[model samples]
Target: MSFLQRLTTGLTASKIGTDRFGNTYYESRKSWLGYGRKRRFVLYAGEPDPTTVPPEWHCWLHHVTDAPLSEQKRYPWQREHQRNLTGTAQAYRPPGHDYAGARRAPTAGDYEAWTPGG
Candidate 1:
C-alpha cells in the first residue's frame, strides 16, 4: 500500500475483523458520495496476495453480503480452504503432465484412425 493510502486508511478506516490467515478487514468510517457505500479492503498479514482471502471474507470485501458469513464448517466432511498453488511445487499435476512424467494408460475401446477416401 502507498504512503497516502496508509495515511488515509489509518485516519478513516474502521477495523471490522481479521481472518484466520491474519489478514485484517476494514471499511471506511464514512461512505463516499459517488460510491454510496463505504470502501472496504484487507491489510494482508505479509505479502499482499488476493488468493489468501477465503471465500466468506472475499464475499464481504466485494459487498456480496452486509456482513461476512460465520466461520466455515470444520467437520470432517468439509474440506479445508487452500490458497492458489499454480506456480508452486505443491500444485496439482495431471498424470500426463510434464512434471508428473507419466503417460496415461490406454483404454480398451480405442478409436480407429481416420483415413481420407479409404
Candidate 2:
C-alpha cells in the first residue's frame, strides 16, 4: 500500500456515520496524545475543509452533544448549516461594487486651476 494509506490505516475506525454531502466521520479506536486520554478526531473523506462540516457534526466534534444526529431530536426552528465564504468571489457585491464601471460623483467645491511656473 501507499505511505499515506499506511499511515491512515493505523487509525482504525468503523463506519460510524456520514452526512448528506457524503462526508464520512470515523471514531478513532485509538487515543490521541493529549490530556483527555481517550480523544477522538474526525476524517473528511471528501473535501477536507472544516467549513464542510455540518452543524450537527460540528456540535459533536466540539463535545457539545453526546449523541449523534441520527439518535438526536432536531427542532423545527433549527436552520441548515452553511459555510461562511465572505470576502471571496462567491460573495455578493451590491449595485456599485467598488469602482469598476462606476462614475465618481461631482463634488460641490471643484476648482482645479494651478499653474506650476506662473
Candidate 3:
C-alpha cells in the first residue's frame, strides 16, 4: 500500500480474519470519511485483485457472513478462484477470433450448396 492509502484507511480497523490467499480482512466502527456504520477493508497480500477473493471470504468482506472464511466448509463442487485476464495472453480466445488462432477451425461434415433447391 502507498503511504497515502495507509494514512487514509484501515489504520484504526480491528483485525477480523486472514484468508488462505494471504489477504487480511479488517473491520472498523470508527468514522472513516464521515461514515457512521461499520466498514470492511482488506490488506491485500499482493496487488489488490478482487477476483482473488474466494467465495467464503467474499461473503464476510461484504457483511454477508457472520463468520470468517475459515469457519466455513467448502463443498467439493466449488472451484478455485481465478483473476480476470481480459487483455493478457492467458485470456480466453475462441477459434474464430481475429487476434489469435486460425479463423473457425473447420467445423464440417457432408455439406451441400443448394442452387434454388432445384
TM-score of each: 0.76, 0.55, 0.69
Runs off by more than 4 Å, candidate 2: 1-3, 6-11, 71-84, 99-118
Q: Residue 9: error of model 3 in Å?
A: 5.1
lDDT per residue (tens digit) for residues 29-89 in model 1: 9998999999999999888889889888999999999998887778988766677889999
Error of 2 at 58 (Å): 1.0
Backbone clash count for every predicted candidate, in the order shown:
0, 0, 0
For model 3, how does the per-residue alpha-carbon lDDT over 9-74 read when each residue is reduced to its tens digit? 555777787888898888885756776567887889899888878777788778787766564576
Better of 1 and 3 by lDDT: 1
TM-score of 2: 0.55
Q: For model 2, what is the C-alpha lDDT against the true structure?
A: 0.64
Per-residue CA lDDT of candidate 2, range 1-118, in tens?
A: 3578547755565446777656766666766666563444566655566787777787777777765666346599976656666867667655555723454555799677899987
Worst 10 residues of 3 by lDDT: 102-111
lDDT of each: 0.89, 0.64, 0.77
